[model samples]
Target: MNTKKKSTSRIMLDYLFRFKFYIFLAVLASIPVSIISASPAYIVQKLLDKVLIAGNNNYLLIIVVGLPILFLLKGIFYFIQNYLMAYVGQKLIISIRYDVFSHLQKVSLSFFSKKTTGQLISRMTNDVNMVQAMVKGSMTILNDIISLICLFGYIFYLHWKLTLLVFVVLPFIGGIVRKFSKKIRRVGHDMQEKMADVTSVMHEAISGVQITRAFTMEEHEIERFHNKDRESMKAQLRGVRVQSTVLPVVEFMNTMGLAIVMFYGGQIVINGELTTGQLIGFLAGLGMTFSPIKRLTNINSVIQQSLAAADRIFSLMDEDIEEGEEDKNIEIDDLKGSVEFEDVFFSYDDKYDVIRGLDLKVRPGEIVAFVGPSGGGKSTIVSLIPRFYTPYKGEIRVDGKNINDINIKSLRKHMAIVPQDTILFTGTIKENISYGNPEATDEEIIEAAKMANAHNFISDFRKGYETQVGERGAMLSGGQKQRIAIARALLRNAKILILDEATSALDSESEALVQDALENLMEEKTTFVIAHRLSTIRKADKICVIDDGRIVQLGTHDQLMEKGGEYRQIYNAQFYFLDEASGE
Candidate 1:
């Protein structure tokens, strides 16, 4: 890997630097804003000395007119600086959010298995939003630092002796800010994690509402959600308490320094060491520094929060995407549906093997049925065909090429899958049918739907193809959704097909209709079927009875029946209940 992982602060700086031109403009505006902030103190001195003390009434009009202009210029610069900083900050956040979202699309499926949907959502939305505060915090620090320097310089110019007294409070203020920073960063990080827990509970409750109602566990789910919500509230309150106390403590320190300067300056004025106007101007300059000090303290809190958020965002971005995700490897032009598995051993977790020493060879346009008990690695065997998981001990080849040597996208293009649970997005009937082949024409989509035995029921709807299917196709019946999924597979028209208990959830009549559709789809393609219903495999070209991750019997249905082995016993056991019910 050529890429080096970056620290969160460095990553944020890189994003901020992308809009350096805007930052430069804001900096330029802040310079004038800083100078204007100190101008009022100078004006107060001239007004007292020339108009009041010296009785020079002519200078009164100039000072009166110039005070408003100084403040007006400050207003203009402040607006320019704030607006520019905000624009740059918002742009920076957009870039970070985009990177986070784009990175997720390429990560391996295993990454998702180990993570929850709500945790990812919280990082993508809440964490990214929090990082935006970094921009404002940075700009506030920059502006305040410049303003503080100018105000202090004005005070030193007016009276050098008193300016030295201001340094007395500096060390203690520094100690206080440093003391709180680490604790603030820790709590801020903790608060964000608690909020993610709250989000996770909300997501689980919302997504599983159907199951919740069916089980009559509404009260249980509500209590679960409430517990998470209360934890988040406590965390938020802890963060707020820490943040609120910082400003007051720092302000109190600034007030103490101000009080010392006021007492000493009064003594100087009484002793004829300084004029009343010069004293007031020095005090005004000293007073202006308080605002900047208070603002800098607040910026520390903002920075700590942003740091907490950036840490989470970068952690997600750094997750490894799928191996060989780039299509540097190549495969065949015309894929023949031939497949061979040579001593393949696989595992979902590294410790336990799910498919052990499995071997199979399939000719082009052949139907291979895998019939086994639950957890017999039937689904795992088919999943290996599309290269969803790699076998550690063996190889799977398609059309004379090892699947590992083929581009992932190119490898999966010549195949389609109909899972036990049909997954359909929220869209119209036509959209769901054409999901696999979005470029398919309306006529082609209708033809595929008709072949899947879904067109008749779809046409019965008032809006026909345009009828809405709610989230996960909730508005449709189980058989309707399964048919639409089959239609999606039909639209793809791939060379290899896998039916993973497709008709297992349907009623007998619906199963027959879906079975007919499956038969139509099986023509001219190499098919792999993992069926719970033994009758579904009686007409299959070959039936492989698998148990304990090994194929115990492999033969045609008649050949297996004649052998009188595991396949015969499994078929007898399944049909015995059906025969008894029918009074056979």
Candidate 2:
């Protein structure tokens, strides 16, 4: 589904229309509240004219009883209005947040690479929250307008001439609002950007805390955060400055208009052209009208801020996700895993190709290993197998079927990946192991753990399978975490396995245990191993030595060693030269 970019107004209007029923009820609730709000002025006018001046005790009963009834009804309707608006605001926020997060899952990995975690987090949290406030402000402005209209109707009934004069100064106030609106929006955008920066800095500091402490650079991180904090503070202050000028200017205009009305209306009363009750009632209605008007004016700044936030949120919602192949809906469950890459050309940046015209084939159940220097596109090849990225100009196939024709979810279901960096959620060991195959029985989970060589150590703990591994499995040692990850993959029992430099960072003892688990896991599945250590892939069925984004040597390790090519050079560099240097 292609989502065209939406304007801020259109996006807001979409949500408004989606929940129109609630909005309608809320608007309906505001009508009575607005009518009752104007009642106070009318009641006061009646009390003055009939009770005080006329000395009519008959008006006292209405004042004492009718006013309370109106007040009670006003309170009830106001609660309805407030509750419905809040309900709409909260509903919109939750729906949008869900869409944003779900949309992110459907997008390609390229999107994540381009966006920082903190920036995305801010979009979900800060941006969504800002939109919530915007919704409330919009509802407030609507209700205020309704209230203002009701008050205006009463005032005009009392004195149409004075009502016209009150409207005279409104143009000037609106002009002032228009003049400051762009500047306020600019400041608000800056403030949001600076806050995102602060969030990014905090994320980096927290994630890299170990590195910072190891290098004794805590003060450096603190100073960096301080700079971002100060920038955010300055941006907020600028927004505040622009917003502060708006209300005062609006209030001053209102005061001047009120003074003119008071003087002219008082003169009319003295000339016996108007009754004191009418004059006071008009003034009371005028005061009520301007209160909402003032609130409406202040809401302008909040509206601008929300529009800025809305723009960002809509932009994110419009980002292009990885689309499925056009009209191709082939479903695959159990794959034969006869993988092949034909004339594949790929590039992270178009200028520099990462996988250049690469070609390879692995027979079903073959154990193929890719060995290469750091930048030689080894990881890129395995990543392409699952369509994490698409080739610039080539085709990838599994069992003679073009990968692009396969449903992405169905294709991925047959493959399991244990990456170099193992990530585990905060959960019990049993939960982590059963992450991939959630329906696995306890016996099956323990069997998979045993196959991964994780069962012994796991049982050593008092809680066994129920032991909690803290955030990202922080409570577990590196080898323990890696084994758990492998156990998860083992439980998946996928037809194709991708081991990406799995044992590169482990100690010798841990590497041996992980290698034993790997040997067992690779028994019958077609495996693609990305080997960093030269010793690991010696027994692989086929070894492809990659360099400069192309395979330069292809053979078994023994064949490559005998061929005296790039493969032999790498092997000697790691085995012979490294051993000799250590001896020295």
Candidate 3:
């Protein structure tokens, strides 16, 4: 989906409209609260004129009885208004979170490569929280606005001439709000960025705690986290300074307007142009009006901060998640193991081609190994077969049909990968094995684990298959994790397999057993391997030597050895020490 560069208001409005029915109820609830709020000034005018000055005891009992009933109704409606808006705010927040997370899953891997786990986590929890406050704040503003309208109506009824003068102070208040708004917004945005940095720093330190202890870098890690936290604190303090100044400036403007009303309204009463009760009621209503007007001034700060948060959140929501994501209309129920790359030109950054006009073909049930120097694009070649990345030019065909024309999920369904660094989710051994095929029976899971040589270690534990792997399989050793990964792939029963140093972590005995198991598993499958150990791929039908993004040699291992090139050079580099020790 293309990113939408929507305005702040539009972004908020679009979501609010989704729950407009509830929002309407909340605003409707506020109307009664607003109406009851005007009752105080009217009651004051009546008590002064009828009960005190006119000495009318007949209306005294009615005023006393009516006052309590009016307040009781106000209390009930106020509760309704507050509860409804809070409910709406919470629902809107959940919707925002749902969409953001769902979108993250659909985006390409490149999007995740550029983002840190902490920044994404912070955006999900912290930034979304900030938007939640904005949502509630807007509803509060709306309630205050309705109150202002009611109070001003009563004030104008009491006396229009003086009411016009009160409005003169409005333009000044608005000017002061405008003056501070930009500053507050800038500070708020800076504060959010600093906080995200703090979260990222903490995440890295926590996740890499073992690395820190191994190198005795605990003090350094602690100091790094402290510095990042302090930076966030300073940004928060700057925002507080900006917001704190806004209130007093707005307060000063309100006090000035009230003084004008008091002096002029007092003169009008003395001159017999207005009744004393009417003048007092006008002041009462005007005082009520100023409270909301003052809140309206502070709203500039709330609104600016909200806009800043919305800008950050909406930007992520608007990011273009590249085309050809999972779940396309095209599905492949049957797949031949054959894959061919035709004149592919690729780049991680478009500046230089990583694979310059490369071409390769793999027959069904063949083992193809890629051997090269580090950063020679060996891994990149295997990565392209899964469509993890698309070639800038040319086509990758699976079963002789362009992969771009197939459903990504369906394309991936027939393939399984065992990455160089094994990642096992926090779960039991049985659960991780069944992750490949969730509907697999317990017997099938045990069978796959046995094939990968993981069943023995798993059965040795007191909990057996139920033993926890901890976060990222921290409780398990490297070899154990790798075996489990292999078991998962074996259970998947894919026609196409990718093994990136799948046995690198295993001891010699385990490696021998796992290699045999893999050979049996790879019997009728097309497999791609990025081999660091030259001896591992000796039996591969085709060995390709990749150098600086192009295949420099391609033959059987023995053929490549006899041909004498990059493959032989890499093989010699690995066995050079052993060759010297043996005096070969």
Using TM-score, give the best candidate's number.
2
Runs with alpha carbons beyond 4 Å of true place in candidate 1? 1-4, 55-59, 271-273, 502-509, 578-584
CA lDDT scores, all candidates in order:
0.86, 0.87, 0.83
Off by over 4 Å in 3: 1-5, 324-330, 461-464, 502-517, 575-584
lDDT of 3 by residue, 204-315 (tens): 9988999999999999998998998999999999988998888888788888888999999999999998888888888888778766767766676777777787677777
lDDT of 2 by residue, 1-584 (tens): 22365568877888778899999998998888878876778887888889888988888987898888888998999999999999999999998888888888888888889888888888888978988998899878877887788888888888888789998998999899999988887887788888888888999899889899999999999999999999999999999999998888899999999999999999989998778988888888888877887788788899898888877877787877777655669988668889999999999877999999999999988888898788899999999999999998989999899988898888888999989899899899999999979999999999999999999999999999999999889899999998999999999999999988664477878887887887778889999999764445765899999998899999997898899978888877766664465463
Ranking by lDDT: 2, 1, 3
- List the pairs of residues colliding in candidate 3: none
Instruction: List pairs with backbone clashes in candidate 2.
Output: none
Q: Model 1, 472-566: lDDT tens per residue?
A: 99999989888899999999999999988664467888988887888888889999988665555766788988888889899998899899989
lDDT of model number 1: 0.86
Relative to the unseen true structure, what is the C-alpha lDDT of residue 34 in candidate 1, on a scale of 0 to 100?
Answer: 82
TM-score of 1: 0.91
State the number of backbone clashes in model 2: 0
TM-score of each: 0.91, 0.95, 0.93
